[model samples]
Target: MLLPIIKCGYELCKSENSENLIARAYPQLGKIFQRFAILQFFNDYGEFVLHDVDPNLLTFFRSCLSR
Candidate 1:
């Protein structure tokens, strides 16, 4: 999910000469980049921006709902 959004953003940023990639894809990719940023931020700072919910909620949700 995040991969696709990142790929799309990269492709858009690479393919277009515009400086407004965020505006162009925010509706579609904003959350994706936010998530990626959160993960990267955690890797760098050992914490996420959102503190209201456990960060592991995503992992737990995935584990509970088997594919």
Candidate 2:
């Protein structure tokens, strides 16, 4: 799911019409990439077993990306 989304984003970013499309799509694209990064961070660090990450931090990240 994430792979496809990232691929689409990359394709769009490479397109000739990217300037106009990306300008309008930046917010949505940012949210997708941010979520992917967060998920990847936990997956890479083996933090899920400890479950130590705070939910509030995720919420804060989402809020910041929304802007």
Candidate with top lDDT is 2
- Report the Cα lDDT for residue 34, model 1: 55
For model 2, state the Cα shift of residue 10 in Å.
Answer: 5.5
Per-candidate local distance difference test: 0.59, 0.69
Which number leads on TM-score?
2
lDDT of 2: 0.69
lDDT of 1 by residue, 1-67 (tens): 5577568777878789676865776564654455556555666665544453355447434543344
Candidate 2 structure quality by residue, lDDT tens digits, 1-67: 6678668876877775668777777787777677667766876885546775568457746675566
Q: Candidate 2, which segments miss by more than 4 Å at Cα? A: 1-20, 52-67
